[model samples]
Target: MIGKWLDIGPTTQIEPGSARTLPVFGGEEIAVFHTVRGEFYALVNKCPHKAGPLSQGIIHGDSVTCPLHNWRISLRTGEALGEDKGCTPTIPLKIDGGRIFLLREAVVA
Candidate 1:
């Protein structure tokens, strides 16, 4: 568990059923999303293609559509769907008492 607690503002920053980008650890961005099931997920904000910000992407169910080139990445597995190649790193997020926390390092599988 290379997990580290990353402070990404308050829990309210990520609206329910929505995703947002957070800047931490030397300006590295992380995309935080709250599922309709009330579960939280976090991933690298940069897309594998052209380094697009995945946080600005749209959330459709358990997938996120990269805003840069319409590439879709799974919020759960960080695997690019459709015609995309390569996978983005994912950080595990655990929120406790209104403070959003994430692992300092991402795990790419």
Candidate 2:
């Protein structure tokens, strides 16, 4: 029902070092992050450990620490950081004209 990319509004929607949730119609919920370094990334909202909501996790560098168990997940690669195991899926994302766009194929069918 949408185009090749999902336009998720302006970059200002998410503040630095924070994240927001985007519900996907045919896939898992996505967590969009605005790092303090002015970079943006999108990953599955679910944590690899215990399926915790990654959106509620604390953002530090390019990683988010799972609030459920302090499991750190890399925003860029979605891999668990440090000794943590497992990984969450990362949705391809980009920014243009101050708006965030997610790869349509990686998001929903």
Candidate 3:
């Protein structure tokens, strides 16, 4: 399914500065985010620091702060910011006709 897109849902389902979760049957749970600036991003729901559910974390700009440890993660790169030293996995996403899609392979692999 290379180059294929998996339609998650419409953009408006997730409010600005918030996120929604998509569960993969046998894979990792994903967090789809809509930034206050109207940008969209997707990452593995887990935080790099303590595996906190990022979908439950607070979004600010292009970063998300882990709710458990308050570690900030870069939404664009999935890197733990500041004194942190870990990285989460980011999923490739695109917005088309107000719908959100994730790369098919990336979502399952």
Clash pairs for candidate 1: 4-104
Q: For each candidate, what TM-score against the reference?
A: 0.77, 0.94, 0.94
The alpha-carbon root-mean-square deviation between model 1 and the true structure, to one decimal in Å, is 3.8
RMSD of 2: 2.0
lDDT of 1: 0.78
Model 2 residue 95 lDDT?
99
Residue pairs clashing, model 3: none
| Cα lDDT, model 1, residue 33 | 84
| Whole-model Cα lDDT of every candidate shown, in order | 0.78, 0.92, 0.94
Per residue, candidate 1 scores C-alpha lDDT tens digits across 15-48 of: 8778887666566877788877777888888888
* Displacement of the residue 60 alpha carbon in candidate 2, Å: 0.4
User: Would you list the rank order by TM-score, best first?
Assistant: 3, 2, 1
